[model samples]
Target: MPGGLRHLGEGTAAALARELKEELGLDTDQLPEPPVLRWVQDQTTTRPGSTEPFERLHLIHTLNVPDSIRSRIATTEQDANDTTQVVWVPLAQAAALHLYPAIGSVLTTPAGTSIGPVELPPMVDGTYRWR
Candidate 1:
């Protein structure tokens, strides 16, 4: 689930490796190349302190980590003002949660399926199940 904006002159695989290294403390050799892209989300939102709309492109990739690091991954990550919690829930359980892109169950789709352009309305209830 480690993700970040792609750096200039870097491909997606390299960017993914960078994010995984920075966020999960994993080295490139520990990770396989060419992650499987699961989805591409076209997200639009209003950032804090701004009324104008902001657009972002999300590339969702599925990576399988060895058991060595799967359960040992840090659950909490601290930054300036945000804390990211990592958890591995069953796909069905995760689908039931109110997730952005609403990628319910598609995560279990067979390989080679290109799920893309996932869009949805803003949640007025301010409720989100982020993992």
Candidate 2:
């Protein structure tokens, strides 16, 4: 669930593998294929008090991981001093939570509506602090 921007000339799959090692210390040898890009969000926003605008393109990947592996990775330390607490929320209740990029929109939609990529609206006012 934790990843970073790919290095110059580095493939997405390779970058993902490297990120897993740096973030959760997970080994990807067991996986048949690398995680695929699920969501791509392009956002432009100004930090709480900043007058200047910040623009970013975020890519999200999803993988089918074993429960044992998930548990182990969730407890491990991640990159960039990230202290994100991973919690599993049922889809039925996820819509009510504060999810970044408001992924709830997709989760709340009915199946078979879209087949390919989805674009999410920009994140609104919020404060971010990395621990």
Candidate 3:
């Protein structure tokens, strides 16, 4: 999913739209509906070179990109960070990768189906589990 943190005073949809266009050459009109805020998670993390631990809130939203748009997507993506390969892995096979806000239970749902708006239990060892 094309994702990014919301800028100060910017709403979620705006941030996501910006990321999608910047990263995948897509726009907000391609979305089926307003993105769903599936869950909010807080994980304590240290910066790349810092020793200080800070709380980071991850707002996980589901972007329902239509098959038409998805089909036209390129095999690679770029962001402010760097260019990266886009691997299309089936949801059933996602368990093999380390996904943050760990898409734990939702991995079992059919692709394109949204997960929960439910509160997930606190993460164990900094890994977000959806159960």
Candidate 4:
């Protein structure tokens, strides 16, 4: 997924569109509406190899992509500043990977577990720590 905070006065959908184009070279005009906010985690973190502390708000959205677009996406092309690697992991082996917000419960929850939104736990740290 694209990263970076929203620009001044920009809405979520617009920021996502711009970030998609700039970071992943994806076109959002042909895609569906803005994604549903699946989870939000607030964290106090520190940069790698640095002692500075900062607050980070993580927003995970669930966007359904059509098979046509999904098929065209052969691989995730990263931008110069993006360090994330996108790969497909089988649901059975998903736990082996390092994932943030610890989505194990979310993955294991049965379908129709609830009708409305699902909110995950938040992270707080006394000192600087990077995930």
Error of 2 at 80 (Å): 4.6
Scored against the true structure, residue 87 in model 1 reaches a CA lDDT of 77
Give a tens-digit lDDT track for model 3, residues 10-112.
9777887777777877776867787777767666655456667656566776666678878876667866456677777776677556676655566565545
Q: Please give the range of 10 consecutive residues that has the lowest summed lDDT in model 1.
A: 122-131
As for model 4, its CA RMSD to the true structure in angstroms is 3.5
Query: For model 4, what is the error of residue 108's alpha carbon versus the real structure, in angstroms, after optimal superposition?
Result: 4.6
Give the residue spans of candidate 3 off by over 4 A: 47-49, 110-116, 123-131
Tens-digit per-residue lDDT, 1-131, candidate 1: 45678888998888887787777666656654446666766666655667776666777777767778676666665321376777778776777765665456465566655455343343222432233
Expressed as tens digits, the lDDT of each residue in 19-120 for candidate 4 is: 766666667776776566666667776657767766777765555667677666536645654455556555556754446645544654544466655766
Models sorted by lDDT, best on top: 3, 2, 1, 4
Residues forming the 10-long window of minimal summed lDDT in candidate 4: 122-131
Check candidate 1 and list the clashing pairs.
none
Give candidate 3's error at residue 105 in angstroms: 3.8
The predictions' CA RMSDs to the true structure, in order, are: 4.4, 3.9, 4.2, 3.5
> What clash pairs does model 4 have?
none
